[model samples]
Target: MANAFYKVPQPVNEPILNYRSGSPERKALKEALAAYKKEALDLPMYINGEWVSTDNKVAIHPPHEKKHVLAHFSKGGSDHVNAAIDAALAAQPAWERMPWQDRAAVFLKAADLISGPYRARMNAATMLGQSKNVYQAEIDCVAELADFLRFNVQYMTEIYQQQPNSSPTVWNRMEYRPLEGFVFAITPFNFTAIAGNLPAAPAMMGNVVVWKPAETQIFAAKLVMEIFHEAGLPAGVINLIYTDGPMAGDIVFSHADFAGLHFTGSTKVFQALWSMVGKNISKYRSYPRIVGETGGKDFVVAHPSADAVQVAVGLARGAFEYQGQKCSAASRAYLPESLWPAIKEKLVADLATFKMGTVEDFSNFINAVIDERSFDKISSYLAQAKKDDGVEIVAGGNCDKSEGYFVEPTVLLVKDPHYRTMEEEIFGPVLTIYVYPDAEFDTMLEQVDSTSPYALTGSIFARERSVINYVTDKLSNAAGNFYINDKPTGAVVGQQPFGGARGSGTNDKAGSVLNLYRWISPRTIKENFVTPKDYRYPFLEEA
Candidate 1:
């Protein structure tokens, strides 16, 4: 029930050369500038109530232009992980015992901190560290972080204050208690907003947290912790350790106090974690909740009546934004045969107009992949896709990683919807297009359901009155976050909860008020205004 705030000084901006010219002088200048940038913004893991950097470090290259390397992050290990978990466990009692209003105060203060001047630095870190373009980084990392903080405060307050109608003889009250111990968040690199919400949401609901963000995105995650501290959250309320998945999983599953996991990553990784949790489910003191949003083979459907410009813009941005590294990126497109040629032509024309470069490059529309591993995986998919029968690489499949992990925005036309490229979650800037014959809508729907084991998200584009309602009804369970004329990646905090079921994940959307429900155990508290001397009420006694 105590608080303290630290005022973080704003970072001063300095001008640096751009990536347009590959001249040796410009290259040296950029490298030197990056060294200064690293010195200016080196971040560490927040463990055991302290900010500490690790001995091991990992390099980050900006995805926008690939002009220079970004800051190196602390590559924390098991020791760091255990230390953080210990801190969270120690802090859980005090945090949980605090009044809900006090807890809600921290969230409000955090929202204020995010919306203040510190937002610029958070935005910059997201842009440089993850190579997100301005709009993407600002919305996901800055604006959305604030939104999550604010929404959860209002949400948890209402939840804790819920009351039901009561007769004169009896009174009933509801209580929502945090999980027995610390909740752990294992997040991905795609959305910095998630890195903020996954842990904060649980903590705001009276649970402590241990977060293990992807190593590549540690910088952005670290900045979020600073905001938490600035908001006057007590030390040890939330813990962060930057470690790889397997090691982190070992720590999470083996710990007796581990309560739940809020995860976002590949399907394979989620499966492994799911299996690990299952192995210990019986032996644990208490059952831990499992919530995840994994890989997605999301799609975009365009009807013959769809607008050419609208379809073209949606497809291009949804396909190539963040270099298509998002789980909800539109990897597959289903076009009615009547609109196939027109859609393709418009898409090709718009793609040609896109500019590719580093985050600082104003003209660049697309950025680099997270690292070489992703670069190799995406390139390999493109290569294998080229040799496959009944598939045509349409728009862009060129890859140039001589400088950084870069792949061109690629489009493939599949002769059959069952092709591997069309079915799998490629997790890159590669998209597969399928042309369906007219009057085969039902068949196409069946094919879509069968081909995609992941139903994380999908979109439908049509103008007819019945079309919207029909598509919504048919694809009701197809996606956790569906779209009519929007991209799947920009799911807001309060409006629509994000996440999916099936192979996609357990469908616990991170930003929704519903997410807090998963981290807590609801206990009903009943008070008898007058003693119930008799055994039961008339209905129960009669039965």
Candidate 2:
């Protein structure tokens, strides 16, 4: 019997469940959080479908409540990374040879698992471990992660269906082959969806992966491993590691079989890795494919006609959600002189209403920054703002690390558009405002474009149609993900297609077919229907 050609259901985004005080979702989540708090998980490195333990360990804690011990994971070293690469190389041929439909089923099943049974576990883990509130956790851990899995399965089929046209006398077929060797996925700590998508995206395209996640994110990343295993992903397809990133990069970048890097992290590390790869370019059997999405100093701009209430809400939600740790979070703003007063008033009121504490409280809108390093960095910026003559701390400037790494959502008003806070990426809940005369909106737009090296996400708020069109056309290269009247953060998987250029890493839009294409190499096969008795071809005949 011929194999059945199956079509996956079109993926719609998972809806965020409102965890209101009396709601069922809230009660269930509260119970899950409480249960998780009492128990500490011991995580082992995953290799060749087996749990491997090591003497080196790192403890993970909730960023909002730093003293609470959540989990500890076995740390990987060069030896472990080497073993992982070997295992992935051994598994690559078999995994790639499996039928495409069969491969699609595994990821589709993983989406189902995330949508159903694994929902609570994923959300709760992100809320506690990553210090996101209930709503933020729901959107990232449950909704976006499931969307990547579901949509990527459909995308894989789409990639397979595309083929070249052929003439009647001959047949042309194209094969989408996995890369010759293994992919190394280096993930960041900001998003749970990214943690799941980075490694699985490559593996879904039939490439074996040696995955390493940020230490702070191991709690949720380990859960992602469980979901894939339950969905019947075969052994050795994706090997998860915990280790020093530099050490792993040192070994993997120089290896003969190193085929690609699937990464989302800081710009500094990505650049360092790129340099190392360049230095060892000749050592590899084939040139490695480099795909990465890195840091951004995103912005929000208000025209004279913009609404103060909406602008205030956008800045609050965009800049403070998850403590503004997202690469797409708004870090700078350009406001008209008249609009600044109202925006300042409304933003201060909104900041006053925010309840800051642990994620266990559903009412708290803000949480702690990621770790001590992040805390110190943000605090240093606040200190500089307080001391410098170029700025004023308008809304929030409090920092308390007695319990958790908490910094108040701060705003700085700058006379100079080129101030350091206006250009640098703080990666926290700090926004710099530069006010311009109402006549200088165009000039301000240009200044906003030129102030920062990064161009990841940005937004423009204007009710005037002409002004909107003007900014849209003028700031065309300002951001990869541009917003109309909305916030730059919270990009839906299939909708916005997130990425950026300039100082940003390669604009490989994740959650799209472009990103998946990186993991596959194409081969063309042609056959002639007619065979000639003689070996002479038409080209051999004299004209």
Candidate 3:
């Protein structure tokens, strides 16, 4: 029986560890990385709290060192997808019935495990498997993942505390119930934090989940499931399966009990899933909630008043970090003709200083792209830019994939604002800059707003308050998470409730209470204090 309203531990953002040379964290991380590199793991599908293996194993290789094998994950098919869904459905009743505090405890413990003992292992996995540098891996897999877990618990409690106003004769309350069926969580490859959070969010809200992580991400994802299991997540609460996307979607989307989708991937995939759900709407037990954070041709627009150094730094970090694989990475920039020269000089200097190599080398700022496919795609863009008369290679246009998928941090100065590189998402360490007339800041803002179909993230750099205010309002609909002076990439969990509307996603604002609301169905309960003998209103008294 429920006795008290349990207050969860106050949520705080997990502090990022700087693995500087000679630091204990650096030493520990180095040891972990070496350990991971020494052995090749045989990973398995986590279903119903069991490690399920199969003969169909896919080899995993580090993007920065593709010659070496890191792990091989057992890939499942339609049968495994069906089995995962079945496990989730079977576990739904007891899992949902579990106390919210108990549910919160599970993830909270997972958060602690992530930040404490499991931190280095997680970071090492991300570095080796996904080609993230030490700092990037720490911020992503450890700090950010912990933040999502702890902060989401706080958000869930806040959601449950919301109540309706009660009348003098009636007591009214709002009950936030978990959804009728299971949730499907399709996570991306770039962020291990996202891979962990996508399924964990809905499961924390008392919903069962069938999680499908990208093949490229499964190496670290295995560690995530292990941490969840260690933290006491119940069997079948979150069934992690490896399978073909379309095959899994066919079963999940067409099922009558399909409840919702928690997705982070490309715009095309999200749209296709949405369409499939729409087509099969009649088959579902209830309206399925679709929440997605999709693709972006994110921009960084600089004003003449902006400091050249600031703009340069923003572009350097925002556009090139993690090889610009982030959906929020700044792929396009519009610089004023007045400040272009200084910005260009500083940006080129920064690019020149960046050392590109394997993630094992802490001195290297740049690493390989995720795979050969991404490498080829990005190389094609660079190739076209080199051939086109309308663009100039400003700096770093070299690509050598002889050893690994290495594409140099490239910059293109485009004559046309709507050039293919400027409008399209390159998803690599490539930034396309278009120099507009210094006097045409307003026109450039309009162009920025209209250039991309995505409204995910964008940044505007200006010193003047008037220019900042005007540009902010003008490009209000251009980005979901807009930045004034900072880069658009590192959105903190509790601080920035991240999401965007108008093709980017549903803009449910993850890291806030808004996202938790999506996984629940609320029912209002009203009990009359006094029973009326007559079934007539005051108007029936015939005054």
Judged by lDDT, which candidate is best? 3
| Candidates sorted by TM-score, best first | 3, 2, 1
The root-mean-square deviation over C-alpha atoms between each candidate and the true structure, in angstroms, is 6.0, 1.5, 0.9
Candidate 2, residues 294-372, lDDT tens digits: the string is 9999999999899988998999889888898999998998889998889999999988998999888878889989999
Best by TM-score: 3
- The TM-score of candidate 3 is 0.99
- lDDT at position 13, candidate 3: 92
Steric clash pairs (candidate 3)? none
Model 2 whole-model lDDT (C-alpha atoms): 0.89
State in Å the error of residue 166, model 3: 1.2
- Which scores higher on TM-score, 2 or 3? 3
**How well is each residue in 1-543 modelled by candidate 1, as lDDT tens digits?**
335432222222112223347754335434533554665356688876788787787766565435565667778888888888889988888989887777877877776776565555666677777878766776777678777777777677667667776778788877799999888898889889888888988898888999888877876888888888877788888988878778888878988888888888889988998899899887666899888889899988876677867887888989999899888899998889888877789999989998887766646788888887888889999889888888898899899887667789999998988888888888899989999987887778777777888989898888886877887888888888899966566677777778898889988776666777898888886777888687876887553
Candidate 2 residue 33 Cα shift, in angstroms, is 1.0
**Poorly placed runs, candidate 2 (over 4 Å):** 534-543
